[model samples]
Target: MLRISQYSSVSSQQSEQQYVPLKHVSVETFIKFFAADVTIKQVFRNDETKPIEAVYCFPIEEQAAIYSFIARIDDRELIAQLKEKNETQREYSDALEQGHGAYLLEQDEKSQDNFIINVGALPAGKECHISISYVSELDLVENGSRIRFVVPTTIAPRYNPNTGDVSSPAGTTSKYVQTAPYTIEFRCQLEPLKWLEKHPPRKGRVRQIFLLTDGEISNVNEVLDLCRSMATSTRIFSFGLGHSPSRSLVKGLARATNGCFVFIPPNTSVDIHVGEQLQKALQSYISGIQVDWNLGTTVMSTPTRIPPVYANDRLIVYALANDP
Candidate 1:
């Protein structure tokens, strides 16, 4: 999952919120056994009259490794190359000064989970396509029966005391003409589950209840207790809407039922978030999961006990092998 924020320059004031209009985004994910390969393509257009350097910040899983970054600018394609940070920055600045196009990808200084992309000297009215590809090991969950993968779609705001500025909050509506009705296309392909072919399908049942509200619950304690009692038979997905919804109540109900929760700010579309929840609800549940270790050594695994795993989600487990 990727979240993006755009700025005119790297040195621009963080308080000044300026975003380049996102025209389209396409994501393709391929899953094979315990690994996933993901590719994301994003198109951004320059509407300002003058050429501007664009800065984009995005996040990925801490364990995910990125192997490719490519930028397409009006008949020219540039592939990113690795170099010392200072040297790369110097070359990027030189390219801008010489009126040439340059692209730079670097890990964020403050956080390893985040990355920064610089697109230098994009001319007015032009469009650039940025593609990023990465591969990550999928986690086994539900006693090693199901595989889970997640792509983050949101970036929470952060305050920087040094700059006296705050990172832009997620879910802010875009005002660009092209972005007002932007669309994101997503596709996922998974390898066939050989175990399913070998064993009979289980007769499992799933009961789902969706709750959407502005978080104005009167009997909060009673409601939460009721949700907790229904955990054995029901899954309650909750959505909190508006500016001042009761986050505690909304999140509590979902937590009690072992479900999911989403918070939608004012003026943002509700369908997208709802659709995502619906997709998760529709995944088939696999049961009777078991893992067999055959290595000739004593192995200790963190999370000595397995946690409940959701369908199509990743679970990471660390193991240490001890020689006999």
Candidate 2:
């Protein structure tokens, strides 16, 4: 967990609590339904991993969904039992509401009804301070009577709301763990989706873009055209970094393809001037999308290649301002 510091002497009560650094911060506007990710570092068979909170193994990215996180105070063991019983939820366990801020839960009306608990703040030096967090929902972490709610550097098993479950919310208990004729899905990025399912997105609202080239598209223009015309609501964005460095390839591809062209710099030998110039180009491209962005006005975080974001009919690339 990252070391937390700046919680204010802010609130004296839980309802007015916040996500504090050393002390307290507000949970205002942090409510969520679930969360999802690609990386999986399983330390143990039963011991959960915080980096990747996989609720279910989506056979395809199209079958998956996303939700927000929630928090509350409750029994850790009891939460797990409830999740196990609730097929809609992948797995849930304990936290502190008296456990409320410890566990992150879902806020969907369907699953929320299953969680019936009232939470409050813990006292310090005979005085109580409220809890605040970024998760959609939360529970306090209790050790005996002490509350160690926010541990930034260390993460325990938490809930994510982005992915859908195996069952429907309206399904009967006996048949609850099954998907009927209903399911809402969004496409995940290629790498993240690959982490969840061996295959990529298909069916539902996902649009499949087929590359006709026998080999990988070496030209950015050719790749961009394929993405632009073929991508539709769901399009494919392609580029390569290994053998050839083609500037024309990227520019043309970006123009013809529906997605942006990206070039990743060499890790060990990338020249500083070249790297900085490339950063400017990428920033300018992204800024074209978001009207308020200033590509060269300020010393901003340089834009880096982004993994694609998939939805029923789209594949979006979020060019982050950092490296992997």
lDDT for each candidate structure: 0.61, 0.26
Residue 223, model 1: lDDT of 57
Tens-place lDDT per residue, model 1, 1-324, is 222233234343332235544689888999898888999898888776666566666666544678999999878888888789888887876665567767888876544445777776778888999999999776443334666676644333322223333232121221211121334232211112122223323347556778786653323445566666656666778987765454455656676776776777789998998887887677654433445566688888754544345655545566677873
Q: What TM-score does structure 2 among the candidates reach?
A: 0.18
TM-score of 1: 0.48
- The clash numbers for all candidates, in the given order, read 6, 92
Report the number of backbone clashes for model 2. 92
Model 1, global lDDT: 0.61
Q: What is candidate 2's lDDT per residue for 6-99, written digit by digit as tens? A: 1122222111111212223332232232222321111111111111111111111111222323332222221212243454222222222122
Question: Can you list the residue pairs that collide in candidate 1?
Answer: 1-151, 1-152, 148-313, 148-314, 149-313, 149-314
